[model samples]
Target: MGELVSTPLPTQFGDFLIKTFSSGNEDIPHVALVHPEVDFSKPVLVRIHSECLTGDVFGSRKCDCGDQLHLALNQCGAEKGVLIYLRQEGRGIGLTNKLKAYQLQEQGMDTIEANVALGFDADMRTFVPAVAILQSLGVDKIKLLTNNPIKLEALKEAGFLTVERVPLIGEEFDSNRNYLNTKREKMGHQI
Candidate 1:
């Protein structure tokens, strides 16, 4: 595991601090958001969100990435939890290839098919560093908020005590319906 190198930044949200950490592995940058008044000794709410530049940054309608992010931030802020933003664009295929995959999706290909066509796995993200971040913060357990079962399994394998799975249910739209379905069916996510 890499060293926990993080620097805090200010946020408008109540007593929130954001930190960007280097992955030390040339994959994606890892980030951690610490909320005010969180008890490090107790289980915290954690959201392991993979990078979705188009939706997260530009508000693209192809998926619910941005909405999920915003919702995670709000929920975490309210409950004094943590949000670990992993920089695994397009499920760890990186940005350039992700854009190419987007073009393929526009041509009627689902997210999984687009990645497979591009010679990548359906979901290429890893969770080792997420556990590292949690450990660095002295967190031993969590109430995770996510629809991806892979995340829950990964955290369990990493030795974190995941006491509960808090479903992050959001409104579905026509644009993101197929994407969500692919995640539920192919990726085994509990959407």
Candidate 2:
């Protein structure tokens, strides 16, 4: 593990303490946005959101990333929890490949098909960094906010006890209905 840095981050959601786990090579490190006063004894609310440039920042409805990010932020802010923002762009395939996958999707392929067509898995993210962040914060149990069962299993496999799995069901739009369906049917996401 590289050096972890800490900083103050006051967002619209609330004042938070941001912790970054340096990867040594990436400019944007993995981050944990924690509410100022959290109760570690209880099942803390947690969201491990992968970096999504188009949806999270620009409000693109192509995927549910933007909505889910904001939802997690609000929940964390109000509930005094943590949000682990991973630096895994486009499910770890990087942005360029994500865009190419989008191009394939435009040609009538589903999201998973698009990724496969572009020579990538549907999801390439791992939860080791998230586990490290949680452990660094002394959080062993959490009520995870996610629709992905893989995330839940990964956390459990990483030795974190999940007290609950909070479903984050984002509204599906025409732009992402197929994508969302693909996640539900093929990828086993709860949606």
Candidate 3:
């Protein structure tokens, strides 16, 4: 991966340096929002978030993605952390398939069931790119902001020296209760 560009971004959460990382073929590059006061000497706070077009952009209540993202941003802003926005929409199934999966969900399938029906894994996302981004930033240790055990495991599997998990729980809503249940029950998310 190569860092294509970086610039200062002032958001309501905080002022940050946004860097774009691309693998050349991807039209949408992964991004890292770094707080101005971020320090590398100690374990830095980091959040590796996959893109959720419906939830993150349009505020869909089918899942708690948008809430989680906002919470992460706020925490990152306050703690001088980094938020890596990975372009792995729908957990790597892409937007169209994600929409299709949503249709299936409306027909009574759970998230994983819909993805499987679409002939894809429950979560096809890879943490390799996120790890690469962190490495590029010279971040050896991290206090990962997430409730997904997969994220913590991914970092350790990549041989990250010190990886601590910081819980990032999203608000539970009636619309997303089942969705969250599937994640916590079937996918082993630490909710």
| Most lDDT-accurate candidate | 3
Q: What ranking of all candidate models by lDDT puts the best one first?
A: 3, 2, 1
Rank order by TM-score, top first?
3, 2, 1
lDDT of each: 0.84, 0.89, 0.92
lDDT by residue (tens digit), candidate 3, 1-191: 66889899999999999999994456899999999888998899999999999989999888989999999999999999999999999999999999999999999999999999999999999999999999998888899998888889889888886557899888899999999999999999898
Task: Write candidate 2's Cα lDDT for 31-146 as tens digits.
Answer: 88999899999999999999999999999899999999999999999999999988899999999999999998888998888888888887888888888888989898899999
**Clash totals for all models, in order?**
0, 0, 0
Tens-digit lDDT track of model 1 for 35-65: 8678878889888888889988999877888
- For candidate 2, the TM-score is 0.96
lDDT of 3: 0.92
Off by more than 4 A, model 3: none
Tell me how far the alpha carbon of residue 103 in candidate 1 is from the true structure, in angstroms, after superposition: 1.5
TM values, all candidates: 0.91, 0.96, 0.97
Give the residue spans of candidate 1 off by over 4 A. 1-8, 25-28
Reference-based lDDT, residue 27, model 2:
82
Q: In candidate 1, which residue pairs clash? A: none
